[model samples]
Target: MLDIAAELHEWVRQGRDFAVATVVAVDGSAPRGPGATLAVDTGGEAVGSVSGGCVEAAVYELCRQALRDGRTVLAPFGPTADDPFATGLTCGGSIDVLVTPVPRTSPARSLTARALAAAANGRPTALARPLPSADTPEDPRPLLVHPDGAHEGTLGGPPELDRWAAHEAAALLAAGRTGTVPGCPSTGRPALFVESSAAPPRLIVFGAVDVASALVGLGAFLGYRVTVCDARPVFATPARFPAAHEVVVDWPHRYLERTEVDARTVLCVLTHDPKFDVPLLQLALRLPVAYIGAMGSRTTHEDRIRRLRETGVTEHQLKRLRSPIGLDLGARTPQETALSIAAEIVAVLRGGAGPPLTGGRTPIHHDAPGRVRRPELRPPGTARTSPRNR
Candidate 1:
């Protein structure tokens, strides 16, 4: 939802008003999960989407009414047994969406502001909002939580209920998944929707040549903070690597020594030379970086593995390396090869097996680059296009 957030920030800065529609709950066979958000502005223009395409026109009308009447609503739209919209969902599932108006200045706006700021700083966050009662149909609770476990709203139940929801919020932030926990009649799960907003992963390229340049550019497009490091001064200049957030002219191992490498970081050795790539691979294998890739051929990879094993990199660590460094897309050029590698990184992030697209039954999470948007099209000059935030 970073796109939505950036759009909202710009709109707020320009003194415009908008409302957000979020899918807060889903039942059997639902398309999108809880926390899918679509924001509609005063003009009716929107960014982000909640559903596939069934109820957007209905939602836009609701957003216009809410803006006009100054009311926020918990709305449900679905196909009845007799309604043509009954084909609303491809999977024939129903969803409950929470449509809340963001006042010029209110708790909701403040919470969104805080979330945008935290995300800009690369901090993880979660937005926790209570589900409207399936029985009562009137009550709703909204909560926002930071990575440190601090919370802003209550779920309108017991103290224990709020505490349990808070713990769930923190856990969701760490896992980077959006879901809900039902409020059991006795156990008190607190029926809440938690949306995880974490910083993008880090992609570090340990080369400064043409292939490294392509990899850096592709990595940035894929939402990674790209860093290019090399010991050579002439090749590692900022002009050659303008898209990279940082260019470090230092020995690869020396630079990695002072850096923080974790499961959220990816290291790619594109030097291809045995002397440069071997030492860096040896050092990178010791860290917890989620993906370690080296650009080389099968023969080169075999030779590199032999050297790594001799240099004390365990077999377990060697398995973590994507030596040929990409999916077998049979990519030939540097740009195509970079695309293959970046696609692999995305597959790793979402825990996908990177299997062939043919007959793939499992749905791909985050269908679009950003979040959801209002499905209907408004007449010109009726609505403004705003971005989405995760």
Candidate 2:
């Protein structure tokens, strides 16, 4: 899986034979979504998780079998008795897993190798394989689709079918999701499973405070490429924030104005000073970043709003800023405050309300769109570099 690409890539480079079991489909409340993979080498070494801890042992055995037989299999696990020996998910959901062998000499091996390499290098890629359904014919080969309209492997289907699948996979790659798409009707396939490996989302914290250190650590743990920026060099040192991918010593506003950001980027303003917060909030609110939060009390937030309005920030743009920064978790320590902030950021990105999930009507997993809509910030006829270009 892309999550463990570094380890898997090393295994492939060492000429080790392995088998990968991927969840291609899910029904009801599955613990893991589609594209969760569990890989096992011939020597029984394993990495990654397919179904949390519910069916790992069963899946591992399936991988070992696939490696020995050099055959691909589709195994379904659910609450029913479909699979006599198959482990059932306790969460009352059903999932269909595809177990495939990746021997060094197989065509699938080359495709897997290419995908792992791309993921290791932080390149966006999609791996599309045919699901083994009753109505679908056998398709052992998988295709690797890249962002530049390039692809590897062949489905042995019509050229049109391949093009259609590539387009579908590309869309998923852009959205940073892994799921199944309807197969080509003309090709008589039931469905295709697209596993997307996109670059990690970015979290840019614009203060070198104690909270920033905790935030950078938690952001990295959540698979974000974090950057800590501040005008003060004494506080923004690498020794203070070692978890950050980059510690930038510059004005927060100026750094953000020149740095690249996309729809998935989160900008956190921890600099409570009016001199730093006002200008930074001015530029960040107008940008297309997914989240923009600033730390301050309610009274301070009101004052910051007046300053921002004085600087010509529009009312609509002002709504974009999440002042007071985090959810009301009664947090006092820097670590607990960091957790509250991270929780709010995730709630915004996942379209969740910061409330108890105990008896809520909200879906556990929000269905994200096919592609993240880019913000239209530039004026008409003004050309700006696209986020995907970065």
Candidate 3:
């Protein structure tokens, strides 16, 4: 699955056979949504997760068995009121997991490798496969779709059906979504699990301070393509923020004015200086970005708001700014502060707060309707124990 693309990319490169189980569909209150994966290698090593610790052992063995038998297995987990034997997920929701094997000699290996490599390297790609039904019950094969409507491989069906699926998949790839798409009605077929992915979201940090360096690594870890911009060339060097994908030595506002951003971009104004942050926030708040967080103290935030009011920024745009950014984690050091900021960014995007989960009866998983975000790409370790790459 694209969720564990970095690890699976390595597996394909090394020619190590493995079976990966993906949560293709969810009904009710499941822990993970579609595209979540759990993979097991030939040596019983595993990476990633598909549930909240429930049904994992069963899924793990399912992956292992898939590797041995070279068969595609569609297993269902979770408790249903009508079923007597429900082994996992007591939380009233169920998940349908599809396990596919990519052995060294399997026919699916080449296409699987191309998808994994594209996702791991932050390229746009879509992997579309059909779900089984009583009417059409052939073993689903992958069809790799690209943004330009180009595609490779086949769905083991009619050519027109494959073309229709590719067209739908290219549309989803535009939004970086991963989920089931309605099949071509002309063919009277329904449902193809289309997991489409695009380039990772952008995280632009406006300041080359020490916290900027620390936050760059955290942003990259969170799977954002990070860019550190500062006017000072000496500070905004590649050596300072080595983890960042780009380091630009230009005024923050000037650079942002020319840069391309979208709904998934995150703007972090770490330079609390009125000269830099004020002009930057003036431009950032008006842009269509997911988050606009500025680092400052409460008193500094108040002063900054006053300055923005004088600059003719509308109240609606001002309301979008999160000055004194980050959660109240009592963060002291640079790393802790970066973590707090990252947590707040995630919370804002996921519609969550910084409250402890133990006291709350709310569902643990939050499924943003009509929007599916691909999980972060975590590279696997060579260690045989503690195998999960997350």
RMSD of every candidate to native, in Å, equals 7.6, 9.6, 7.2
Across 257-340, the per-residue lDDT of candidate 3 in tens digits comes to 999998889999999999998888888888988999999999999999999989989999998998799999999999999999
Best by TM-score: 2
Tens digits of per-residue lDDT, candidate 1, 230-286, equal: 999999999998899999999998899898766678888888889888888899988
Error of 3 at 82 (Å): 12
- Report the alpha-carbon TM-score of model 3 versus the true structure: 0.81
Q: Residue-wise lDDT of candidate 2 within 118-147, one digit each (tens)?
A: 998888999888776454445367889997
Candidates sorted on lDDT, descending: 3, 2, 1
The number of clashing residue pairs in each candidate reads 18, 0, 0
- Model 2 residue runs over 4 Å out of place are 80-86, 134-137, 186-190, 358-390
Model 3 is weakest, by summed lDDT over 10 consecutive residues, at: 381-390
Quote each prediction's TM-score: 0.78, 0.85, 0.81
Worst 10 residues of 2 by lDDT: 381-390
Give me the overall lDDT of model 3.
0.83
**CA lDDT of each candidate?**
0.71, 0.82, 0.83
Instruction: Name the runs in model 3 displaced over 4 angstroms.
Output: 6-18, 27-31, 40-48, 64-71, 79-86, 90-93, 103-108, 156-160, 182-187, 309-312, 372-390
Question: Candidate 2 or 3, higher lDDT?
Answer: 3
